[model samples]
Target: MKKWQLQDIRIRDPFFLKENGEYYLYGTTDVNTWEGNGEGFDCYRSKDLKLFQGPYPVFRAPQNFWADRNFWAPEVWKYRGRYYMIASFKAEGRCRGVQVLISDDPRGPFVPVTDGPVTPTDWECLDGTLCFEDDGVYMVFCHEWIQTGDGCICAAKMSGDLTKLTGEPEVLFHASEAEWPVIHREFDSEGFVTDGPFLFRDENSRLHMIWSSYGEKGYAVGISHAQKGVIGKWNHERNTVLEKEGGHGMIFEGPEGRTLLVVHTPNTWLKERVKLYSVEKLILGG
Candidate 1:
């Protein structure tokens, strides 16, 4: 019932989508994102990037929803005249995975379209992000280190209609493969962690991905470059894009047409809140 400024809302994995002249912000809304029976995701809308409105309940779990808790990283993508939200979910006796939900409007009571997660049922996966090319659509997500000693980012072919996955998940890279993640006991002592994997391209049309990991400064955002194409080889930038804690970022063009990177700050439990930075070079030009 309260409105929150960018510095007030306690949310992580912040994703911003600008559509039809309005901005929609979505992500892990729960403070206790690491555990829960999972509360459904929420959305915030605004005409300008500055002032905001409504927590605007976009999704709430139905009684029969497969994920009882740990609903996280919700990103909505508009495709073929409809909107689809790819988010991470978890439950007891089941592995954490990304699932698909649909809605005709960006702000909606989104409901699950797929029977369950498209990622392999046995693997611990999260942060499933959508990417498309002339060939087909793909979901690039993280293969969590909680399940694997070395966390990885994987890509899977999606059905043309975006309702289901069409093939096996292929590995793009791993936490160890990147050089930025700080060796922290809270995040990982023996291994590295891989969080939100969102795809984007710079002005030159060169593919770039901004993802979260523990850096020398604690939780941080790291940048990666595509060597060939969207699903091609990726190179982790030696330096982080944002190393001051708080990652799980998504890049979008603001109303003013400046490229902005939206991410949460602090990166602490119950303290994380959205923050925006000007980084136009991270976005593609028309």
Candidate 2:
């Protein structure tokens, strides 16, 4: 068996799924993740976080695929007994957008399910993840700062089958909205960046979101508590969750019910690697 170490893998926007005693990992898997043509998403299976097995190919692009490059942030969710993927793609002249794919198995050859990108065709969007809210399912994604000059985390209601968006997206907050000291000049003409929005519910059903932004140090993670509900106002923690090179993050339960935050480090173009840190304290209470 070929064993793998977290530092040795070049994956971004890492997402972990805990099944019946097995951990399934998914993320951006293109050989050249930063640019050029994209192949598709892949999966890694493991009983423990360390020594992952297999770069199991999950979804490969079909012929005449709309987007050929910039495949990023592939997040998988088990919905209605079907595995669905929400990832970003970009073509030559078209703006980056999030699209949906479906498969019968978690580690599968997923095929495009949606007619096209669920996000606005002209809007620059990415890092879309599935959000199951009080009323319905929603897509939480980032509107790139490059396009709006002030990146934002937005949420939109999804159809029951998760095929399309049923409502207009509402901005939950901006990159500079967090209550932390930012070292980088993100609020200036350079623009603030908002990436990776994942929702986690505490014991009390209180909702908290983990997202990425550049801070006083560098690529950082921020946690926000939803004041109302899933789509409601969110209050940011005063300090960054991880004020290091690791930014884009998602939480998953590891062995012995240990909460782990999986994120990519260095924030580089293609040299990024996923790292995990214990986050049990964050999920103790609701």
lDDT against the true structure, each candidate = 0.82, 0.84
- Candidate 1: regions farther than 4 A off: 1-3, 186-189, 281-286
Off by over 4 Å in 2: 181-189, 281-286
Candidate 2 Cα deviation (angstroms), residue 21: 1.9
Q: Per-residue lDDT tens digits of candidate 1, residues 45-153?
A: 8788666787988999987888888888899999998899999888899998889989999998899987789899999999999988768998899998877877889
Model 1 misses residue 239 by how many Å?
A: 0.7
The digit string of per-residue lDDT tens for model 2 on 1-286 reads 4678767878888998776688888988887875678988888988877878878989888998899998998988889988898899999899999999998888888899865799988899999988787699989899888888778899999999888889999999887777663534432457788889899887788888988888878888888989987677888888888887987889877888777888998888778898888786543332
What's each prediction's TM-score?
0.93, 0.93
Model 2 residue 46 lDDT?
A: 87
Point out the worst 10-residue segment of candidate 1 by lDDT: 277-286
